[model samples]
Target: MRRFLIIAGLSLAALFGLAAPSFATVSEPDDDPLIDPAPCVNAATDGDADNVIAVCTPLIDQEKTGKPERVKALLARAAAFDRKQQFDRALGDYDTALMLDATKPDGFNARGELRRRQGNRPGALADFAAAVKRDPQHQAARANYKSLALELERLGAQLAVKNKPSFDCKQAKRPVQKAICADPELADLDREIDAAHQAKLRHAAAGTVSRRALLRAQDAYLAERNAAFGRSTDELRAAMKARLRQLRGGKAD
Candidate 1:
């Protein structure tokens, strides 16, 4: 029994001795005050960009710094770099901070603003969307997302109508109509001329002399375009431009 007790005590001592080094290793980092991010936070609050970077860089580089402290340091440094107009460095720090901790919406919003300033509209839109998705109450992110979305929507609508003519291309069978449908610029001119002519007709009283003259002028214009289109496309474009101008002038002749 005595020999068994001796063996058990020795085993317990060996186990504690092995764990002591690990405990010390874990606690040693906590003893170092320099690795704490308090100084970096203070510099950032002071708006002293150079001091923020100087203080935060060392904390960010230290492996002994905890993940939360490292993220704080990285964010502070990023803001400092932004104030200094060191855009690339600021972006790098923002990216690193977000990668380390993606739970914060402010980080995403900041990155989105940076991307916007860099003329990365699509990237900024995506980041703003992410920030809003993460926190619906984030007013800045929501405002940015809404503004960008409306701009894109307007641009999309313009592009959608850019190539469309007033008439349906599928039903066009005449040579001039087919030619107009085939060329985007000619189609646009034709559409504009038609719109201007229609507007003038709408303004004129029905059965009036002016309305009859406008109708005759439009018929004559179409007849001339159909007859001249086979000769030269350049002439067709010029005729269309002249017709558009005449119609827009609100003159019957």
Candidate 2:
């Protein structure tokens, strides 16, 4: 009896010793300063369930942290990423915010923009379609459609430019053999690229969109990327401007 009691006491002591440590260290989730609010969207005051606090919190921390002063910061950041051409991150933030609050037309619009920039035409179109559906009165969406129409015209222009012969260049450091670095005609080409890029940005900022608009945005982006063949900055500018005017309802003809 004495031996059994002693053995039981030893076992109980060991169990308590192990269990006490664990219990003492019990982690309080609320006490965790890192515990972000659920949804974890860039602009969301409270995060979303489709992307809950646990999963999205780390994503938010990795890309976007802290509550936005307003939705503006989130939108602006999305635009900046789209500008620097970081499409995936921008879309993640936008989608997260939209998931948190679908009523915010801007979130849907921005996600659509990122999708457009990323070359996800179908995704972008869907997002824009949703935005327009959510808010039919959105002016940005109206302007975006016009911009897309111009982009379609611009695609034709780009094909024409591609067929046009590149001029002689004095640029020695050109990476490509067929580059048009310093040609006098470069001025026009530069404008076209800029226009396409700006149109892309305008679409991103539109806060609403359409399928036609999404396709045009994609075409414009491709045109812009293809323009970088040691082309003259002046030419880039010209291409961009012409394209911009075209997007703004001007006839390229």
* Tens digit of per-residue lDDT, candidate 1, span 109-176: 99999999898989999999989989999999999999988988988976886766778999998888
Q: How close is candidate 2 to the true structure, as a TM-score?
A: 0.33
Instruction: Point to the candidate with the largest lDDT.
Output: 1
The lDDT of model 2 is 0.55
lDDT of 2 at 138: 70
Tens digits of per-residue lDDT for model 2 on 1-253?
Answer: 9999999999999999988745356666753355343333443333332233234445445434455422444444555555556667567657656755677766676776666666775666667667778898877754554565476587778766652333333433444323434343443454444455556566664645654575677576545646564434545445555665565567562
List residue ranges in candidate 1 displaced over 4 A: 1-33, 36-39, 46-51, 82-87, 117-122, 173-177, 185-253
TM-score for each of the candidates: 0.57, 0.33
Residue 9 accuracy (lDDT) in model 2:
100
Please give the range of 10 consecutive residues that has the lowest summed lDDT in model 1: 23-32
Question: How much RMSD separates candidate 1 from the native structure?
Answer: 9.4
